[model samples]
Structures are given as structure tokens and as C-alpha cells.
Target: MQNKLRIIGGAWRSRNITFSDAPGLRPTPARVRETLFNWLHYDIAGKTCLDLYAGSGALGFEAASRGAKSVVLVESNAQVCLSLKNNVAMLSAQQISIAQTEVSRFLAATAQGFDVVFIDPPFTKDLVPTTCLTLENNGWLNPHAKIYIETERSLTLSGLPANWQVLKHKTAGEVAYQLFERG
Candidate 1:
């Protein structure tokens, strides 16, 4: 059976969003997503968001439901991208865009900038720091944009972008969330 997930808040609260427990994919817990939106407050409204390593497009979908002006989800896996595309269609999110590409490739190719960027790379590899750096280096992140990063509790991010500052951080079980604001 497929796992049905609900949108945490905004216009689509309690609506079901489909997800799969497949290899190389892990959706952030609902509680964590809620905390994230809470931290963002009214910033989620009308902001463009980039969902890197968008497993189920859960984060981007939530942003859309919460009034994000646009959501761009980048995923390489064909199956996962299909699911993301389908879910966006089901939600009737006109501002949601799906890109079927590896996160690294998308990072290099993307010209679109976002007001908020969500990165939740696979925990098996230490990709978060490098990916964040790549985005910052490539100008994929707009100045003063907010970036939400999720990682295993013990993972350390060294040498972050000089302009980004940690605005808040919280831990939930094995997961740790960090919110950064670009200066």
C-alpha cells in the first residue's frame, strides 16, 4: 500500500499527498515540516522555493500549499519525478515545477533564483555542505534568501557561505534542522 501524507498547513491542510518508501528517498517527518513552516512564518507567502533532492516533492508541495509564489522540485529518479509530477497535478498547484535531474546537475544548470531553498540530501552521503556551497557559489540562492537545511543529528556543516547566518536550529530525534538567512 502507498503511504498517504497530509499537507501540514495553509489552504490544503489535511489533504493527502502520496509518497513511496523507496531506496534513496526519505521524506521529512510531518512534525519537522510543521516546525519549518512555523519558523518561516509569513515568509512562505509569495516566496519562490527550491526543493533540492526533492524526494516526494513534499517540501515544495507544502510551500505551495502555504502560498509560496512558486516551487521548483529537482529529482533525478524517474519514478520519483513521476510521483512528484503527479502529486503536483493532484494538488492543482499551478506554480509548481518539476525537473527530472540529479541535484548536482540541476545546481549547475539552474538560472532561476529562489527566495527560499530547501535541501535534504540523502543521509548516506555528506552532500549537504557541498550542495549548499555549490548553490551559493552559483548564485542559485538570492541575496537575503532563507535556506532550510536538514541533516542527521551528528552531521556538521563546516565553512558555510560567509553571507548566510544561522537564524535558528532545532533537533528532533535523529534529525537536525538549521535555518539560515543570507546576508
Candidate 2:
């Protein structure tokens, strides 16, 4: 269980969100989140982002804090969604929005494409690859959008969209980070 959550950078530099690891939750570590955004958003200002499976909304709020023009965080679980809403309100991030729906539903509903899409589904279920496929199938992504994928290091991905290719891949502890773009 993580006791402290942090904003990666920007106006809320040292801000912390107290996170308790409830069932099916593992918030990304501060260092990893910071590094992930740094690589993905060379200059995130004015960019739009969608954070799928936004556990705790850590990554989504991080983008908004860093000056993303619009950031949406989607979560289905009622309890988690409530907490996510509270966190978003607490941060008072005008650019941020929260949707109470699973990733698939949100993807199916939103026609708004994003410059960056951060996918950090539950690691235990190993849903990262399926989520990636669904996103492409549901047309949630722009042709040139960048993806930040996090998954357990042991999972192997297959059947990726032909045009989607990895730009950078790395592992920190159990979290594997893959930065992907169109081929």
C-alpha cells in the first residue's frame, strides 16, 4: 500500500496525494511517472491527453499540472471513481475531467482524439495488450498519437496494429514502460 502520492512536476511540484492500495490498485511510482511523462511530452503544453484506467488519476493530473490543454481520466469502479473525482476536485485542475466508465466504454464513447494516451491497466490481469488493441479498434487514437504503455514485465504483446510501433521500451522494477507511435 502506498501512503504518499506525488505530482510529477509543474505548478504542483511537491504536491502529494495519499493513496491506499485498495483491491486492484497500484499507483505508479512518482519517479516512474515523472520519467514517463518527461519522455512522452517533450513539450506537453497545449496538448490533449487521455489516461485510460486512470488509477488514482495520478498520471492524468500530472499531465494537467504540466499544462496539458485538456486531460481526461476514465475509471469504471464506483469506489475508485469517487476517489478519483475527489482528487481531481482537490487539485482544482480546470483542464482535467473524469469519466465514470471502464476504458472500453470510454473509448467507445469519446470521439475526441488525443495527442497522448497513457494506458496503465491493472498489472495482474495483464490487460495491456488487449487494451491497446481495443483502443485502435474503437478509434480512440489519432493516427500520430503517442502511447505510454505500462504492464507487468513478464507479459508478451502480440497482434499489435501494423502501424503502431514501439519508439522506446524500458522496465523499472515490475513496471514495464513502452513508448509507441505509428510506424
Candidate 3:
């Protein structure tokens, strides 16, 4: 199966990008994206971004379209990676790069720091907090970097870094979304 996710704002506003129907590949809803970008209003332009679990590439593409200097999308599934590539080509986005690897592996190998990091792992796995720790310990985020996390509403965030502060948080249906700043 195939589906489309629209870029809600920025240069690519109103554009629709296709994605594969891979399992656990839920794209962030338009309302959520709008809210997230609003929270990140002035910080996105010319900043480097990391989408830990690219999935439908909605968030990464939106960042690129919004004037991010560069956006790295990391996805473990091959099918989803291909879909991401297709979207990149379709959008002619020069600021986006795709990494066909797991979040842990990519973080372990890369020492680059990003100004913004999006962490939306599959709901079945408890990877958000662990990934957050890895990003902190591995130096993958610049000081005061913004990290966006999405998970089940019932999950506890006890595993996240001590210095991280929730700048914004909201709930939609069964999902909980938050934007944190590393202090």
C-alpha cells in the first residue's frame, strides 16, 4: 500500500509526498506538525536537523522545506528508505540526506551535532528515552538543542536525560508529543 503526507508549511507548503505502507510508519499529523513547527519557529532556519526515525519523512522534509541547512533522516526499513528517496527526488530537496540504518547504529557511528533532533520511534518499542541518552552521551546534539519526542500517552519519561527540559508538551488521542531543550 502507498499513501501521501502533505508538507503543512514552509517553502513546500501544500505539497504532497508519497510514502510506503510499512508497519509502524505513521507520519505526524498535519495539526501536530503545525504545532511542532510553531514551537520551533525561529530556530529552524539554517540549522542542522536529525530525524531519528524518518518513517514517512514528513518531519524531515518539512524541516528542509522550512530553510533548515541540512536534514538527516535515519530509517531502518528498506522500503521506507526508498520512499524517502523518492520524495527527495520529487521535491528536489538538496538539504536532505537519507541514512538507511537503525537509530542506534547511526548515532554510534556519527559524531555530528544537530541543532534540532526529532525522535519518533515505533510505539511497540521503548526506544525514545534510550535514543535520547545516546544522543546526549554520543555528542550528536549541540548544547541547548531542541529534541522532539512522540510516544504513547501512557509511557513514562523517567529514562530521559536529567538536564533535558520539556519546552512544550501536548496529547492527541493516544499519542503524546513533546519538545525538549537540552540544558
Candidate 4:
């Protein structure tokens, strides 16, 4: 089975993209995306972005639709990666690239810095802290880059980089999302 999501704004607004019904693949809700993008309104255009754990490619696609210079979506599942590639082709999104690999492995090997990054790992895996550390320690973020994270509402966000400061936070139902800036 497949699930579809609509791009709520930008050039692709109201366009629908499909994703496979894979386990642990939860796309960011439209409401949360709307709020996140609002927070990123001024920063997204012409920026390079990394969408780690790019399950459904919602965040990355949204960034590309909003005029991001480039977007990298890293996901390990073969089925999900295929869906992401198809969507990229469907949109003719020259700015988006899909990296088929584990989030940690991709972070370990890539040194390219990005202006923005979306971290929405599978719920209850406790992946955020370590992933954030890897991104910071491996020089994967540009100076003063913006990082967005979505996690289970109860997950405690600790062990993150010392210089990262929370800029915005909100909870809707079972999810808690936040935006952070590298200081």
C-alpha cells in the first residue's frame, strides 16, 4: 500500500507525493510542517539542506519547493529510497538528491556543510542525541546553521552539542518538534 502527502506551500503547493507503507515511516504532519516552514521562511530560500532519516521526504521536498538551492535526503530503506527517487523525478527537482544509507553512516562519511537540516528519526529509537553529535563533530553544518528535530513527545533532548540553542519548540499530540541554531 502507499500513502500520499501534499506539499502545503511554495511552488509545489497542493501537489501530492506518494510514499510506501513501510514500517516506522511517518511523514511529518501538515500542521507541524506549516509551523516549521513558517519559522524557516526567511532562511530556506537559496539554502542547502539535509533531511536525515528522510522517511517520506516531506521536509526535504518542502525545502526544495520553497527555493532551497539543494536538498539531500538520506534514508536506508530500499523501498523508501525508491519512493523518494520517484518523487524527485516526478517533480523534476534538480536540486534534490537521495542518499540510500543509514543516517549514522551517512553522517559519518559526509563532510559537506548545509544551511539547514531536518532530523526526524524513527520514534523511540533514541537516535537524536547521537545523530546531533555526529553532525556537529563531523562538520556537517555551516556556521549558524538551522537544525530542526522531531521526536516523541516524551523523549528528553540531551547530549546535544553545547553550542546548539533552542529557538522554537512545540508539541502536537504525541510529537514534540523544535528548531535549533548552531551558535
Question: In terms of lDDT, which candidate is strongest?
Answer: 4
**Candidate 1 residue-wise lDDT, 1-183, digit = tens:** 357788989899899888666686878899999999999987889899999999977889999999999999988888777777778888788899988888888888847778999999888698987898898888887778999999999987887888899999999999999999989
What is candidate 2's lDDT per residue for 1-183, written digit by digit as tens?
A: 445677869878788865545677788887788788778667467888988888778888888888899998888877777777767777787888888887877766747768889888886776776787877877778778888888888878777777898888888898788889855
- In order of appearance, the predictions have TM-scores of 0.96, 0.91, 0.98, 0.99
List residue ranges in candidate 1 displaced over 4 A.
none
lDDT of 4 by residue, 1-183 (tens): 889999999999999999998889999999999999999999999999999999999999999999999999999999999999999999999999999999988887949999999999999889999999999999999999999999999998999999999999999999999999999
Models sorted by lDDT, best on top: 4, 3, 1, 2
Instruction: Give each model's clash number.
Output: 0, 0, 0, 0
Q: Cα deviation of 81 in candidate 3 (Å)?
A: 0.7
lDDT of each: 0.87, 0.79, 0.92, 0.96
How would you encode candidate 3's per-residue C-alpha lDDT over 52-102 as one tens digit per residue? 899999889999989999999999999999999999998899899999998
Clash tally for model 4: 0
Candidate 3 lowest-lDDT run of ten: 102-111
Top model by TM-score, which number?
4
The true-versus-predicted C-alpha distance at residue 71 of model 3, in Å, is 0.1
Q: 2 or 3: which has the higher lDDT?
A: 3
- RMSD for each model, in Å, please? 1.1, 1.9, 0.7, 0.6
**In candidate 4, which residue ranges exceed 4 Å CA deviation?**
none
